[model samples]
Target: MNLSEQHRDRTDIPNADWESHMRRLRPILDLLKEKDRTLGEWYLKGETAQEALQHRAYDGKAPAKTAIEALSKEYGRKNKDDPKTVGIWNGIRSDQIGASLSLEIDGGEIFPKSLEISLNEKNERRGSRLGDYRSVAEVLSEVVRTYDSFYVTYGPFFYYTNKVFDDRPGVSWMLYLPHVLTSSEVPEARALIPVTRDGKQQGTIIVSVTDEVFDVNNRTHVKAANDIEIRLADQDLLPRYIDL
Candidate 1:
């Protein structure tokens, strides 16, 4: 299987100050930059970096830093006429890398706050060596370490394999939870990988099915993932399975 192809890795953290969210974006932006330097430039819907260049947000050539600083100011502003409309909705992407980072900065929603980083199949095949559970788990662990993310899911895009959650892990290759849980909390077939940050065990990463990189086409792998999902639900570990 092409382990990294069509991968979607999402992470969720509780809502916090806007500054905290900007701080969280730094490392993630850095990670994307490692994939494609030009992807560091941030932009809003219906706007382009070249078009935004003349705007005050550019503030020099450092796209990532300046754009986030500009977004912070934007987040703090309010519209007297429509207070609900006063929010930030922006993202960073690169056509060259075929990867993008999308953020949900609105706080009025019922869902846990989250962000998603997606890599198209072509880019994944060329740039990523995520052929096993350990490699993909490490990538997810990086986000957890940077954001202290309480929840994360990494797997191929649902459309790529015609897989859906359906009250199970179905398409997800791995799930990360900040709270510690024993192996007894998961299915016998699953692997509970411990994620450490700053020398402390920050959370547990539940690998779906097997150590082999998850293949959505593999019925065994999909069922193994679903099995772990059911077990986690039984232990009340998955309060909101689909956060992003």
Candidate 2:
């Protein structure tokens, strides 16, 4: 039987559009599965399916807020007298900062060791001056170099799952890190650019390190270092495999 006829006679099926939907959804699902595989190895390190989902949800929201807060404090004016500062602060307070980031790896195991930053929010300007480093001493040094006028911090690391469903839409997830750090010893730095997947730029993940946490709608408190999981977002970006 042809595709439409086969689906039509399958009374057990839940919907009439089942076959058509599956045809379109199959590729997306396969892509999601591949993403999950790559991200799972990097971040989950053998967590259960449910555990992975929980981790991604938490990671996505927390770091976005922390990044927003860190940026606000740095650019916002301290005195009540500066109208520009006050205006900027008020604008930020009223806006919502969304999260959209991922990582790009060269092979299956190696992290690219570079990041790219994309700012889509209004009145939001990201700088490299915050205390952002792998160590505390480096953060302190950046502070001295900037003459105590500037600072930088690292945002949270995000993680996600790599599972895909055959009949369901392809699913991807993300988690944001818990702590924020500033650049005290070294100067602010830029993230490395990512290449396109399948001749498209949508799948590339961008990342950067910063020095401080600015103010946002929600404030993020730091969690222990061991508690953070480092992973990138997982989503559908390629075609699926099907047995005819």
Candidate 3:
């Protein structure tokens, strides 16, 4: 899972800095390794341990287009774009943005090896894309189910209320990747940096870590849980993710 191209920034993150950053992050990583004990909101089990929390989108009725749009926008709003935005339950959601993202894990798996997200022909707005994708988006949806794994990043939203920072239409830290990134493609980049998410989206990385990714203040925040001021593309390391 090479996530290099998922970032919008393209600056060179110094090796020395990365090493030092990891040293500071290692302890947290150790804490994260014990993922089972950590509880999500309401003492609900975390991603590794769940109590039958399934994300039933559209009730198999609404078109994927209407479904995903409603899901992203309203969810983005309710939490003020806080990356840890997710609510768990069954039945249907009533929020204008959409259903609450109920992130759950089967056994110890949170991230899917292969993803099957897509927009329908009737969907007026475009969803995620893979420009280099030889097949159409519609076809990819079917193929993804058979894939072993997929490279990906999060979408855009304001961090910390009013002051919104978006990285759409460009490969920001949270680029929408459809292919597996490789060390050969970006030799300088590291793989699986493991960013953390708060609340339900915890233990996840939202952006691509590159030399150029930075915040509005032009500095790097090694601690992901609190780096709300930083957005990956600020430093100039935009990505052009590819699919094989």
Candidate 4:
């Protein structure tokens, strides 16, 4: 096997398919690591990343508070010691869905917040608050957590069955980090890059294109939304999934 084609030992998917995926995905990975500057994976900031949609409320002339938000608030007050729940999302970068919709990302897997502590924070001790870092940092953290929990048990990908909108199952790939910058326009996927640990590569970085890249001028609004997205790791990736 070549360098890019070395990590396909999964029994879940065919080795040939993994090889093909790696071959096509290598350049994208390099660009992500070099130019794109991605933090792989993201956790869901939704009110209930682990649970389904519950109660929801609205603010006047605007989208009201959601059940997840309410629950999060309670957790902040009473459950301070309890690590907040979070999850990662994967969505198709399509214009069909308006930016206002919360259900944009078609698929995701919810996990506990404690995993973040075990993977990296304990090892490197990147003393940064979730609010302070850019979008990529949180996304990268999620990628590692996902790999540790799901990939170790299953493989690089899994069969994601959407609970609500689309009941049909889709093959979901893990370790793909999206290179995202904040913006007002909806985000779109540009490519997927490989994720590495130590000297070897592990996951894929997702390169996303937003209507506008976050900069000083555009960041206020973008960052606010990112603050929310950071709380609820729900961001979109490329529109590709196997109809398994």
Please name the candidate that would achieve the greatest TM-score relative to the true structure: 1
Clashes in candidate 2: how many? 54
Q: Output the better candidate (1/4) by TM-score.
A: 1
Score each candidate by Cα lDDT.
0.53, 0.22, 0.27, 0.27
Candidate 3 lDDT over 1-244, as tens digits, reads 0121111211232211212222222332232223212211111112432432333232222223333343455444444222321232222222221111232111112222222121111211232222212212212222222221233432222222222233322322333333333444333332322322232211222333433332323223223412322333343233222322
Kindly provide the TM-score of model 2 when superposed on the true structure, using C-alpha atoms. 0.17
Candidate 3 global TM-score: 0.23
- TM-scores for the candidates: 0.63, 0.17, 0.23, 0.22
Question: Higher TM-score: candidate 1 or 2?
Answer: 1
Ranking by TM-score: 1, 3, 4, 2
Q: Give the C-alpha miss distance for residue 79 in model 1, angstroms.
A: 4.3
lDDT (Cα, tens digit) per residue for candidate 1, span 1-244? 2112111223353333334455555665555455445445544332565554433322233334545455545544653121111122223343434444555544444444455766554333233434456666766777777556757777766623443445333326777776677876664537788899778898888777564555566677777777676676777666444543
Quote the RMSD, in angstroms, for model 2. 24.7
Positional deviation of 151 in candidate 3, in angstroms? 6.6
Best by lDDT: 1
- Model 3 misplaced stretches (Cα beyond 4 Å): 1-38, 41-151, 154-176, 192-207, 210-244
lDDT of 1 at 92: 33
> Candidate 3 overall Cα lDDT vs. reference?
0.27
| Residue 197 Cα positional deviation in candidate 4, in Å, after optimal superposition | 1.4
What is the TM-score (0 to 1) of candidate 1?
Answer: 0.63
